[model samples]
Target: MGPTREQFIQYAPAALAVAAAAAGPWSAIAAGAAGAGAWAISVSAPALRSLIACGITATGCGIAAHQVLASGMNPLFALGLAVPAGAAALAHHRNLAGELLPALPATTTAAAGAGQSSQAQVITAYWMEFISGPTQTEGRKLIQAGAVLAHLGLDVGDEHMSFTGIITLPQGQQVRVKPADIASVYGIPASQVEMGDPKHYAPNALPVTVHLRKAPEQPQIAAGIPTTVEELWAAHVAIPDGAMPGTALTLTRYDGPLDWEGIATRERKAIGAVNLQDLAGNLDLSSIQIALAPTDKPSQMGVRVMKEHALMHGTMLSDVVDELAMDSRGYVRLGTYIDANAALVPLAQPGSGARHLYLVGGSRSGKSGILEQILLSAHKSRIAVILASPQAGTIAGAGLAAHCGDGLDEAMGALRLAYAVMLDREARYRTPRFPFTDPLIEFILDEAHMLLLASSQYHLEAKAIVEQLTRRSLKRGIGVVLATQTPLAEDLGNSTVIRSQLLIGGGAVFLRCAKGQGSLVGTNAVEGAEGIDLSMIPPQWPGQYAKIADRDMSGLDTEAAARPEDGTFGLGYLLTPGSQAVQFRSLHLDVAPVSLAGSLPPVAVEDCEAWRHREAIMRTPMVDQRGKNLIGSLADLLTKAEQGPPSAAQQGQPAGPQQAQAHPASSAGSAGGDARELLKPRILELLRSGSSPMTAETIARKLGTSVKHVRPRLSELKGRDEVINENTLWRAA
Candidate 1:
């Protein structure tokens, strides 16, 4: 039925009224804003393309404004209407944000080097390569994704979606997806989808990358028709039934807080292994980091590939014995980080004027083992080592240290001797006529917390000596390596200055430690390291070690219950000077520890005069070391002590004249007085000779007898006036 002129004329009055209003002053502004907003929405669908939206919106707004000014409406009226029109447009966009829709994220990637640099249309035998669009196969995959998304109730459009070609590192195309929505596509009830945060995966998701791989084992990962179908609908991912040559896998990173429980339990569903080695020339596997990305509900995890395949394995120091010589860089090569992309850490900082190396770690964290390796290597380089440990460990018993101390009081004598050496060197370096030795001294103080933090009369003296050593000992050819479990300043006798000085020039190694230890190691150590967290280092039980330690005397080497897939022992973070902090494993000397004790003499810290000076001042001066091998390989020293009480034969070296033949006229001792006897006179000789009461360990170390033998004798002596005992510290009466 065609409308006649009479029918059209019946609605003329309403038409005339509408036409008159269209010509009104605000008409152009209203039309312009509406047109511009529509343009913005159409182009910015799926996701807002800011640059294109800005240019398109401004063009539409200007044209509409020009039209109103030309239609006899005053320019002022159009200008006044612009404010409300702009506000309305903004409200429209704010309402449309965060809505999911089908997208061509593939547009962000380009097929680089696919065709010639400059193209001639006639030369197009490889037509697909010449085109900027995805191939037919890719286009079909994109269409499937759009259809699947639509079925899941998302407002997916029939836009030309393409095959998700390949995703490169750092930045890849992103698509908005919800785990529940993905579940719906696979016929799984949306309620079955587990998530900690529903909005997390929905807001911005990286487009799935279908990395083709084949499982060489049974019970393939991502098993089941539903799971395989969902992955296929998403992007034709790998099939799980082994019907196809390559299995499909997508990557998801789990970036969360690092902790044992978290690392072990964090869920990373993506799994597959690719033999990139087969594609040798075409692909470099080293550049490919095979780690997963994030998921819908992210629980902070401390995950690393270290436990199963730790970088440091069966290789021993004996294998690389030449490392004993200082390298061209003046540093000893320790081990590398736990990454295939990792290298090594040095024993000392070169050209930094003998700046110290500070290491912090908890028990069995490899701090002591690392110290043992360092001392041995340093000695091989002709560097003198004065090894002092307040707590007895394998390092103290390692036999050949020029001067070794096992208790706090004995450690102080080593410290005093080191101080004297530093002073002597300082004076000698001043005289132009003096000859300089290339050999430097390394004073390694193991378990330093007791010396620095314990409450005792010598606390102030110990602090003052350490403070001097840290502040002024460098450049004088001496460096102090202080290792402690807790690096906190308050626990270090509230001596923050000492801590600062120790790590000032970026020299610190933090091994697998407890919470907050790495952060407290000092600001300078981890300054430039982008993502270093020492507390994240997984604790390794001895049973987890792939290679068993030869010795287990300190209880540190005792085995503990562990998982079958564990092996990351001696792992931690080390910040090399000028290098960023990263995970590092301290090396191990493969040889039996006791056998290495007789290898070489440590650079002697004590000369004849210094030895006499120590014996005179030190209450429990560790003797048998007056210019000869003092405390020779505690290897056998400890063995003979365990057999029975003390004897002159137990002494490793000859004592000085003053310390020798102590009261040969004593009647209580009926033995073959071979210049010495155990317990009584030796205890009095130590106390009467110096200032400071000493503990049983200190008295044992001084008298060259075990604490079990010295404790009873000290009790017996206290009954008479031979020695006085106060709270376990013994002194002469």
Candidate 2:
């Protein structure tokens, strides 16, 4: 049941008694149950009950103050009551005024053929539009006096004039005028303006458009027209010298809810394929501001544009190369090349000519990605791949011809086997009439500089073997690709081999690198290809490379790199003999997740038959005739050395596998020590000495052991937390 006056009186006796004591009975009832007080009394809900309680309390206080005043008590009591009552009355009047104001009338959109005189009628008619009742009367007065045009400074122009000022509204709310908002008042498009702190307006005068419209002459009616109309109109038209009055004015509805989705769609299309920075002057943030109410302005908002960079997607290898799409033999698809036309170009034939490839890039620079692509494509082509990496069988372990497991000895062995193959090829080359039949032999080395470092004991031998292979391997259908983080001459023993390999045919694939370092590679490899601006190489463009081919060798003109400059990492340049570098992205196998070297399809026995044929000859068993001959010769030499005085009789004979193998007992002891006991103490010593973390190679060198031997122990130590492996270098835990 709804609350009643009698029920309210029963519940609030004190409030009733106080009110009755100060005023008469009728006055008491009216004061206690009128407006909010009456509404609160009639409601039955808990919230309404609470409001009633507060009203009763306030009423009682008012009654008590009235009684005190009548009794001639201190004036402070009257003042106390007056302050709160006055505030409430003023707030109520303000709210009432806002509610009574009528909204602006909806009108037809202005037509292009609408005469210039119609502009004035449109503006005058717009004066009748009011979002609030209280503002309506004021708007009428302003219009009658012609002060609306004057206040807006109408000049009727193609461009908006701007102004900045703080104005106190009739309701006493101070609003900071925005230049863009002022331009809208004159029916012109606005430029962007910074709306700083809400508390303070900008000091500089803002620019805004002030458009004017000529109206028909009419007799002034006393009730409708004000005395200031002529004066205001005259003041509105006064223009500064040399400033032409703006004509071509268009009226756009100013106060309404914004269409955000439409704005976003339009902007996205306007931006096109250009970068976000390209929209500097063309698009203004204010034009797209979301204003829900008439008073809500762009001055009270902030804007942020989410930008997206050009990230090309992966292209398929088969799609890019015709050979791969067909027979796909003897070609390892690296990546698609981004050609001068910005088209997908494929690298069909790798290791073209004897000049091997040098894949130079920094850590995580998509170097590994490129390597993986090469290996997978090479396998598809039935090319024999020999991998010498720190990790064994990284992408596909079992199908590989050989995996140099994380062992320095194993790595050296792989290279030695390659050298042996080179020797065999040289011998076969002696027969002039031999059939030109042989699978292309690829010696792919990962982290090759470790073996060529000056600190490495076998640097001289390794360098000699690589140089010899680079010079003669191509004719023998052999190719070598060396990938390293550092491809500098110092790291490679000297520039002689690297230079020859690069200049051989297709130049190097230079990934993200320092200007000086990349330039060094270009100049050394491609003649006149110097001063390559590394800045043009996007830092974030992973796997993107600057490839200079034979065509670009003579002249430093790489203007034909590719449009949009950057492409998918697998897309790159392929420089081969007799043709310009083609831009293409590598074809990826249609799998759940494409891997460069890893996750390859199983290698069929038939597919690897060529590799098997070559490997059998290279890996001759020790029990065979060749192995037996070496063993007999080795045994005889050892016996003679033992019988002799054991003086140092080995000057040119560098320490090699054959020499070590001759003395079986000594070799076993040395190998066992290196692989097990000897490396442990050396590692502990290095850590205890407070030396910086060292890589396996550095530790091996210090301990006179192979890197292969130290890595396993390092792994064990790392697991035990006795040592820490930071990016491959080890330190005390």
Q: For each candidate, what is the lDDT?
A: 0.48, 0.43
For all predicted structures, in order, the TM-scores are 0.41, 0.37
After superposing all C-alphas onto the true structure, candidate 2 shows an RMSD in angstroms of: 29.1
Query: For all candidates, what are the clash counts?
Result: 10, 41
Q: Residues 1-733, candidate 1, lDDT per residue (tens digit)?
A: 8644322222322232233234444434444453354355454442234322332343344455657777888887657545443443343343332221222122323233334321111111111222212434443322122211110111112231111221111222233244344333333333333332323333222233111111233555665434332243223322233211233232232221110111212234322221211211111222111111122333321223211244536345566666555675667756555543333434444554465887888876767777877776677766777777877654733454667777777877677666656544543443222123545678888877777775654556566667767876676667888888855664466776787777673377877667766453244233433333456555643223332323344567555543223444566666655433555566654564335544566666535333444443333322332222222112222333344324446545445554435533332233433432455777888778745555676666555545666677788888887887654446688
lDDT of 1 at 203: 20
Q: Which candidate is the best by lDDT?
A: 1
Candidate 2: residue 83 lDDT (0-100) = 48
RMSD of each: 21.7, 29.1
Q: Please state the error at residue 270 of candidate 1 in Å.
A: 33
The weakest ten consecutive residues by lDDT in model 1 span 147-156
Off by over 4 Å in 2: 1-333, 339-355, 390-406, 431-436, 514-516, 521-525, 533-733
